[model samples]
Target: MNEKRMLDDQHFEQMIEEESICTTDNKVYEAPLDALYDTAMHYCPGCGHGVVHRILAEVIEEMGIIKDIIGVAPVGCSVLAYNYLNIDMSEAAHGRASAAATGIKRVLPEKYVFSYQGDGDLAAIGTGETIHTCNRGENILILFINNGIYGMTGGQMAPTTLPGMKSTTSPFGRDVETMGAPLKITDLVAQLPGTAYVTRQSVHKPGNVRKTKKAIQKALEYQKNGDGGTCFVEVVSNCPSNWKMTPVQSNKWMEENMLPFYPLGDLKKPNGKEK
Candidate 1:
């Protein structure tokens, strides 16, 4: 074959190989974790909240804990999570999801209870409830969605909002001189004696999605094993509309800005194992 033709063929072969890997990865759904419902989510395109929702649903289905699971939905975009998830759910006042979940779990210790909360709700108004629940070692899962802004409430500033980040309330960027620094709930709660598992994960990419699912599954497993401790999963999500950015830009911002402030990994785990 001519040298030019050989180069062309090599290029074609590399393209084919790349395509194959992409196809295989797309098809490789974590068998043990599959969504129970269809893909018609209420969230906007490129919303990390939707991805986390799907992951939790898949985990619950895989573990066969749907019937025994009770979820407490907090104020914010995820307040409507009950509309998508096909399980028993209760709505909680802003930032009081953990308290509500604690009450329910105490009444029904055999049931698997979980709370879905947003950054504003979990870190600000609901901070007290969350802290006490974790400190008391409530046997419940806390799926904390930190999008860094009040998504449902017109893009207001949240306790987890990054320094110098612009929001509706902080139009000129959040000033630490007045607004204070972003709250790192995962690190704070992990220090509590009642915390059994504390992980910070994201759904910004496919690999991160898989890791987030595993973290959630581990939290549920810990609860099933009679480990009466707080299992917290802080998902650094995105709010494209609230942030006034396109979906792609929102994702890029999460990787560049959010990751720096809230680094992802298993912050605290049982047996003192490193993640």
Candidate 2:
């Protein structure tokens, strides 16, 4: 017991020493660490998940809703969103994130609830739940991450896969004639009467990161103010590993290829204008 206590004390002292050294710098622009736990992330090095998570944390902290927000996560690349975000979270079945988020928001109307889902989860399997949730105006936020390919599973083609985009299942490039045109889920949800603020934004760079953070803030604001609608924020991200390219190359490819098919901006809103 004596030896164990001494060792524990030594480890604790070492941790404090390391923290003191790291925190000594008076660096400007250091983001607040209130809403994200200090831990290793499982996402790829250049995965936009980290940036998106940081923006969410910034918004939650700025709005003073860190304790009043709940997140619902579905399967796919973001299955572990709850692990990084310091908030009350509930796991949902694959493609059922929207339904689960609706239930949680309904039960606790005062709390801000949001769902973090990937393209495959939202645009394919969860299509019905997503449509219904938006149609009913569940007063929740849907953070849709569309990377065109299934990242969690093998790099399979998704409903949002662009024309001529190659994936594991689409080695010959997506044949739009038979595979069907990409489903613009963001626009589809915006046409629903229950949607309040619907916008497509990216966070590949600092400028876009700021814009995305504001978009998130606005969506939460609408829900908090009893807007009686759904807020859908689509984040066009890249899948470096699945896309078979370096992180930098993948981002560049996304800018050239993905942006043309799915142009960014407000697709739809309650007032027919971005707020």
For lDDT, the strongest prediction is 2
User: Which regions of candidate 1 fall more than 4 Å away from where they truly are?
Assistant: 1-39, 272-275
> Candidate 2 versus the native: TM-score?
0.89
What's the TM-score of each model vs. the native? 0.86, 0.89
Worst 10-residue lDDT window, candidate 2: 21-30
Query: What digit string (tens of lDDT, one per residue) describes model 1 on residues 1-275?
Result: 69666687779788878766656557756432333455476777788878888888888888888888999999988888887788899999998999999999999999999999998899999999999999999989999999999988789999998999999999999999999998898899998889899999999888999899999999999988866498999999899998889999999988999998899998888754435
lDDT of 2 by residue, 38-57 (tens): 88889998999989988898
Error of 2 at 170 (Å): 0.6
Candidate 2 residue runs with Cα over 4 Å from true position = 1-26, 270-275
What is the TM-score (0 to 1) of candidate 1?
0.86
Residue 241, candidate 1: C-alpha displacement in angstroms: 0.9
